[model samples]
Target chain A: MADQSQPPLTRIQQKNRDLILEGALSVFSVNGFRGATIDQIADAAGLSKPNVLYYFASKDDIHKTLLTTLLDMWLAPMIRIDPDGDPLEEVMTYVRAKLEMSRRFPRESRLFAYEILQGAPHLTEILGGGLRQIVDRAATILQGWMDDGRLAPVEPRHLIFSIWALTQHYADFEVQVRAVLGPGHDPFVEAGPFLDNLYRKILGL
Target chain B: MADQSQPPLTRIQQKNRDLILEGALSVFSVNGFRGATIDQIADAAGLSKPNVLYYFASKDDIHKTLLTTLLDMWLAPMIRIDPDGDPLEEVMTYVRAKLEMSRRFPRESRLFAYEILQGAPHLTEILGGGLRQIVDRAATILQGWMDDGRLAPVEPRHLIFSIWALTQHYADFEVQVRAVLGPGHDPFVEAGPFLDNLYRKILGL
Candidate 1:
């Protein structure tokens, strides 16, 4: 059956779907797309297979729902990177916000990583419409910063790419990172100074 | 039966194992550990189920062998980064080598991505023994560069992490990158100059 309940669903459907998505995030983040099974997701969700199927038509349907929902939240911070703000400050804010998300929502980050690693088979449209357009707009803003001498001349797209790589590394490679940083090193402590220096040095204001 | 052939395997044995590994990489890279099947890999290698099992005891064995082999090759260039060389040049050479590998051996890159993405389930020991040790030595070399002011002051470990993230992003997130860059764009062409400027600016020599 379709989700007949509207945007703000009745308490029961809301609770059930929320539970399923939360459980699904954990399972999907670790096992990845092809690796995740409906049974695992159902078990993790504490719902029977038929009960899960009652909400989502199939495994692919559940995955698409999670991914599209993720895309909305994932694009929010970048959308908040105001084109009108101080270039350095705006970009630095974006960097810090992204890193904070990596620390706080590592599961979501890994889930995204798993999908992208598997080639975004279920997300070509979202990638095209949502992510691609936002990146283009951000690139245009970055180019303006370069032209205005508000930031050092760097490839706008690559600048965005570097920002992403530097921030996300903390989450995506946490195992390797923590191992090298040593026990109790706390990546966030180093992350602040490291990012501060990176932005300062790169922007060259 | 195990791989009973001695170190000096007959040409047929060598070729057969190589074929199986090639097939295994494709399956493993596209699908994470839990998602891949012995049937698919065996079929890809042109061997019956039992014939494939003769070469590799189980699917896990095949996956482990593939990752172990990749780890050896993956760490080669870093091991070759001469500490005695000019710091910028040494780092640059390492960067170029990694990027080149991303282009040439993309499947290996993707295979490694899949493993790490899944928490490095089978290769944690290798990470500690092989990868961590090499990173330690590499970090020391980078520290020397920083102490001598041959390279800008940055955390050696994080610098290495940055390089890995930036270079690997091209191969691991190829779909998203290509999608945004558009149909006509060649990522490597733009990537080369972007990275050259990046390290140069970051090192600030």
Candidate 2:
């Protein structure tokens, strides 16, 4: 959020901030908010403690930066649901985008999962305000599609939840998924068609 | 696990142990394994830290106990998917049972989520050995049913994951689910029919 108001930094400063955020993401994803510490983040980031602190005010600050940045990325796909598009294909696009995120951005997905699992103390405001509005708008659009028989009727609001659940599961529970599938199988690659078929079944291909 | 080998606890001892475990569950559910402490568990359990330690050796001990106990309850549902039962109904039974856990035992659900999210360090053995065997058995049964066309064919292993992801989302992401739906909606209640329709579509009711 303050990304807009903060004065632009030199390339070095920007690079250091990215390293700190990347390191912080690794530590925080494993340890949650309570267990993570500045020293750990600094070590993971390959910087001295002072150097890390110079870029961010506190651990909370780094966590928030990661989360807010994440919230934007998280909401982008939903916001891309165009009302004028073919409803089923539009949804399939969202599904593909989310699965691609799970494949490409698993650490980010786990970090988001940890924050939410911990009650989203830093996130409750945006959750109800920004996130809810976007979800509601998407839900309404889905509802319209359903009413017109352009989409199969289920709870439009909850259908989004199913999408989140199915796609994010690949990332959030990757270990369990790998364990279940055993060797020589890529969970995400297999999941692509399974999910494509699933949404098609629910929404009518 | 030691419940089998240890001398049967006296009624008082059993009651005290239950209290400590219940308290530990509350703390550990909110605080992941690394973030939880003996004093906190004792405080939540209404016992002295020493007393809590007496019942459980350390924080790790308590966490392991909770996890091992949870593993049993978690497997009970999947284990109950009878090979001889009606195919779709059996899957529905598993779905309903998982959802019921989300509703009645959300903390447990989040605790399990937190554990898995962190790579299941303490649980990897069971995950790969005991858990894999059961899931394999269940998957094989479903695959057999699919082979017979008694159930609609989807990826049998992955379908189990979808069940877990959808049902557990209500518990693990309760805050997000609530915020998205706004006021006056019970996520679990609404989820029941939506999920029923979903699985029925996938499995062919």
Candidate 3:
């Protein structure tokens, strides 16, 4: 029988898991969860189907693992919004962190977007639990800022939504952004200042 | 052979076409273009495969038709931003119209979101040609407003992108919004005023 409390994954197991996840990310990001197939992921990872299954029980397991990890990374910026930090600086830092994530991890953004677009079937529990917890905490901090007159008074939740919407648009809607901006334009370069100006103006910072 | 450009579609033909498009919208919105099948669309439309094919040659054809019609409706709000109207009013009008579309036609919005998320393989031409043309024209008008000091100066293209992001986020990310807001909270009710406040503050209107 397998040991109930084994040590963490060995080096090879960790490497294989990483390989599977990286391959799954590419497939799932492009094809979405429903559209992607296990064979495709297995082929992408250069592993046999049984080998991949040894790491993940099924396609849903693989997808769930990816999504769980993604949620952690996706919300890290919001979680980092220090309650004790200066209001405007903290908000601005959060915005910058989100936009940088959009620029650096566009596939992850699109993967999440695709899930949300499909009504977040796999993410409902986490969205309601962990996501709501973090958002509520962040919203409380933002409200405190508003109450203390350190930031302009507005709906704190909506403000966070706006930040997410504006920044992630560059990543999730990259094709549309690039189409309108044309060939030579670097969207992130312009987006950084554009968003900074927008938040400043809106927050009266 | 069928006459090439005889009159417009017959009443029955138009009705069937609309039925097909409606079904396609629901399917594509949920499953995405690649994930959706003609049989599913036909079943959703309460028609046989042959009947569906009578109106649209293939799944691609049906998706293309839906996308083409959607682009028109999607951009109509932008096109209605009259150059002669009050700058802020025109911009606000566009924002409201877009938000209303999100509230009324979320499926359409998701269909477009799915296509865009997939790198817009099917929409490159329309995005580059029609979308770019209208955006360029709108950007010109927005730039004029800035030049005349009627509005705050920023990148007009980015301004449009922001409007798209903020407004469509409600529809495209409805699951997340609903999850965070919890039950019995009408997102659109708060969204209307929240967005109005945001744009007013940002534009210094």
Candidate 4:
């Protein structure tokens, strides 16, 4: 989404952009795309509306830019699964990595969830094309493990879906998860062994 | 949330209320609470804004009424897991029931997801009180099963969280799930055996 034709941003420019994006994420994640406004983003970013607009053309531009960056970050965990490595360890690593991300980056997780909950109007192209391609590649690798009997034979895509569902819920549904788990308990820690057991069983480890 | 002191609604009153709620669900589920408007609900319900106002005191009223009803319906599935029933069967029944609800009531699923995504501002009392109580009871039942070795030993609360995460993702992230699966495949059908395997393993059947 970066314009190659433009000159590289100076550090000050880059910092301002990051500030705006961070603020925009706060607004967009909680208020959602339709609900968020430039004024709100500007206020959150500690900039004037004109300054925020000076950085991005419009609210849609900010959202699309945020999602573009997010999809890449989202994919990095999946891409960490090394096909050449031992299958169960690799899968658990991926699962743990996802859980860690949920713990660390809940706001980003909610931003993505909010997008899909509203039908991914800003993200359809990436979800259907780039996202699906990475998932298909991962499926192929998972199926290869199954074919060799290194993992349990299950539909690879649904397995992928399950991994995503199990991990992201910690972030996207943090409020409910925390409320239900009650006080003084860490959800990610509690989730660790259970996810390990299920994945290990599913992988035939 | 129903007013016990109020007289029962006539058939016409009930029908109109249903229409407004249905229309509100369509709007609120898609646009979320901060984004939705009474005018939009009025248009979706085929009533004037004044008429929509006459039935519900405000947009907040419509959303609260809808979510209050949704919580009861949501609890019904968990309540169906009879404690005296075979623990594994009861758990699977609850799992399938949740998945089926995701398939049959995606809008409702997303509405609930959106509410939680935005911090459960309207549903906090229920989440902290009523909802937690039912989940605690189920957790107690699950723990009893584990103590008897009728199910696998794991944190019952985390196991319940896994069930919700895996099933609701189908509805909450339907757009992404459909895009990844591509054309023609029924997600619920594909998800059935996969979830069955998971429950079977987690329950140590």
Candidate 5:
């Protein structure tokens, strides 16, 4: 597996780790967590399962790494929503940011979708701690906007959920969305204008 | 299993068949399609799996029945969005109806969620045929509204997606919503005012 690991992984360790994870993401995203096998992941990485495990402890470990990584990316856009910024612009920023993620990292989005759809069984700790807390803070920001009369009155929390569902739907249900939208329809290009007008109308700013 | 199903289900037998299906819905909705089992459903119907299968073929059969049934119910409210009604009111009615289902029949919502999450493998045929067709028609209705300048000019399909995501989020993500909103918060109650004003703002009437 590497000539007794040749003094063990050092700087090269991080690069191989990233390689294995990239392969794992492609496999896991397509098949789902339970549906995926360690052997398949190893083969995809061009390493043995034990070798893969040598880099990461277990399948769960690999999954956790992928999820935490994706969660950081997912929440970055929401974290950028400035309570101090213009109301409609802030919301539009959030919308475009999320849609952009769907376009750029659809596989990551689908993998996250698979996890949540399965009830967040692996990342309950992350969901309960980091993700949930961030959503709450953002929801509070929206509430603050409503209170200041800078944003139109609405359920700040559900509004966020709508943003998430709409943006993520493009990825999670991409097959169905594409099927229904037909071949020529690019949901992202169509989606940006739709969302911009949506926020403008909802915020009424 | 029962002497050729005890002379086969008759017209009266057909009525009993409906009763078994009715009972399956209550059980499947609460426990989810997978969490639900033949035993729980049979117990709910005061019968055995063999007897249940006599009416329907398998657990998949029962779950498929529930899905098809709910699809009709789910689409009915949206279809009732009168083409001639006050356009804003029409959309608002669709919102209220969807939220009402989310509140009143969350089990149905979860059942659908679980099915879709599992890639709708079992119901892909029905989904491709029935559900997709219905959404197409609704999208057309929405386009009509946009065409008449009755609703804000947005991608009718995405507008529909947002409305769905907004309303269904209350039911589908109730646990997370409750956790963040605090234990005492009733999401629907909080959501009602949020949705009412949201539609009003978006419709701009």
Candidate 6:
């Protein structure tokens, strides 16, 4: 095992870490944090348990790393909502970005869902800290838009919540979506226009 | 231990079954299916493992029972959408019912979310059968509303999905909601008007 005080990871160490994280994402997304195990993650990563432990001290450590990384990526789009952009366009762009994330990074979305579903035991601090900060900033921008009559006045926080709920549902609840849509139905392909119309109508744009 | 082929449960047996199911909901909702154990359920129920087993065949059996029971309750609101009522009223009623379910049956909502996140391994048949039937019938009603220009023309199915996403987000993501809103924020109370305005605006009511 590598020493706790060791220098920066060599190239090989970095690669192994990535592998472990990728495997952990799949296992944790499907099985949830409590359901997942180091052994399962190790097996998925094609590494020995000790080898997995070498990079991350414990299952919790690995989970923490994964969650922090995910939170950053998950919040990136919201952070990118340009304050100076046309209000409707900014909001729509954020919606599409969120929907695209749902389609492309479904496992990541599900992982976050799993954490939230269980009351966010591991993420309470981040949720209260980084997440709160970013969301507050974004909500202010949305409020500004409403004040300018650029969008229909609504609860900024709740409006953001609505956008998350609508887009992430396609990924987090993929099975139900597919089951209802039946075979050969790609939800995202249709979701784009469907969501655009709904938001446009709601915002009175 | 009670025999598998025994006659109907006595009053004592009925009481024990209720205790076990109630306990199972707490454990299973927190831990998800794979993470939950019979011992945990038994402990929660204040029963011996053998006694718990006597009442239910296995963990799968217990989960299946919980899921089917939940499905019925979950779909009851959709089933109540009146075909002959004012289209907007019918739709909003369904929305309110679903939101009420989110507030009143949060554990059940999270339980269903857990199942769906893992690909609905335990609920495929029900989703395709009962759920599909009700949603399809509701979609037809929504389509009728659109046909009469009582509601804006949109994909009825996606609209229903949107409602579920919005309402359920308050429940399933309760932790995030609470974390972001901080103390003194009751999402359900505010959610009622927030969602009502959203649907009213979207439906052009």
Instruction: List each model's interface RMSD.
Output: 1.3, 0.8, 1.0, 1.0, 3.1, 0.9
For residues A116-180, write the lDDT of model 2, one tens digit per residue. 88888889999999999999899999999999989999998899999999999999999999988
Candidate achieving higher DockQ, 1 or 3: 3
Worst 10 residues of 4 chain A by lDDT: A196-205
Docking class of 4: high
List ranges where model 3 is wrong by over 4 Å. A1-7, B1-8
lDDT by residue (A1-205, candidate 4, tens digit) is: 7767988899988999999999999998887888788999999999999999999998899999999888889789898788999988888999999989988888899899999988999889988899999999999999999899898888999999999999999999999999998999899888888899888877774
Q: Please give, for residues B1-205, the per-residue lDDT of candidate 6 as tens digits.
A: 4668968889999999999999999988887898789999999999999999999999999999999877888899898988889888888898899999999988899899999998899888888987898899999989998989999889999999999999999999999998888889899998999999988888864
Q: Could you give candidate 6's fraction of true interface contacts?
A: 0.85
> Model 4, which residues run further than 4 Å from truth?
A1-4, B1-4
Scored on chain A only, each candidate's TM-score is 0.93, 0.95, 0.94, 0.95, 0.91, 0.95
Which digits, one per residue and each the tens of the lDDT, describe model 4 over residues B28-133?
9888987798999999999999999998899899999999998889779997778899989999999999999999998899999999988999989989999999
Alpha carbon deviation, residue B56, candidate 5 (Å): 5.7
lDDT (10s digit) by residue, model 1, range B73-134:
99899999897798899999999999999888888988888777778887787777778889
Question: Higher DockQ: candidate 2 or 6?
Answer: 2
- Model 2 B-chain TM: 0.95
- DockQ for candidate 4: 0.84
Q: Candidate 5 DockQ category? A: acceptable
lDDT of 1 at B51: 90
Q: How do all models score by TM-score? A: 0.95, 0.97, 0.95, 0.97, 0.80, 0.95
* Model 2 C-alpha lDDT per residue in residues B1-205, reported as the tens digit of each score: 4556767899978998899889889988887877788888889889999988888778888888889988899779999999999999999999999999899999899889999999998899888899999999999999999999898899999999999999999999999999889899999999999999999998893
Assess chain B of each prediction and give its TM-score.
Answer: 0.94, 0.95, 0.94, 0.96, 0.84, 0.95
lDDT, model 4, position A25: 91
- Ranked by DockQ from best down, the candidates are 2, 4, 3, 6, 1, 5
Worst 10 residues of 1 chain B by lDDT: B1-10
DockQ of 6: 0.81
Clashing pairs in 1: none
RMSD, every candidate, angstroms: 2.6, 1.8, 2.5, 1.6, 5.6, 3.1
Which pairs, if any, clash in model 4? none
Q: What TM value does model 5 have? A: 0.80
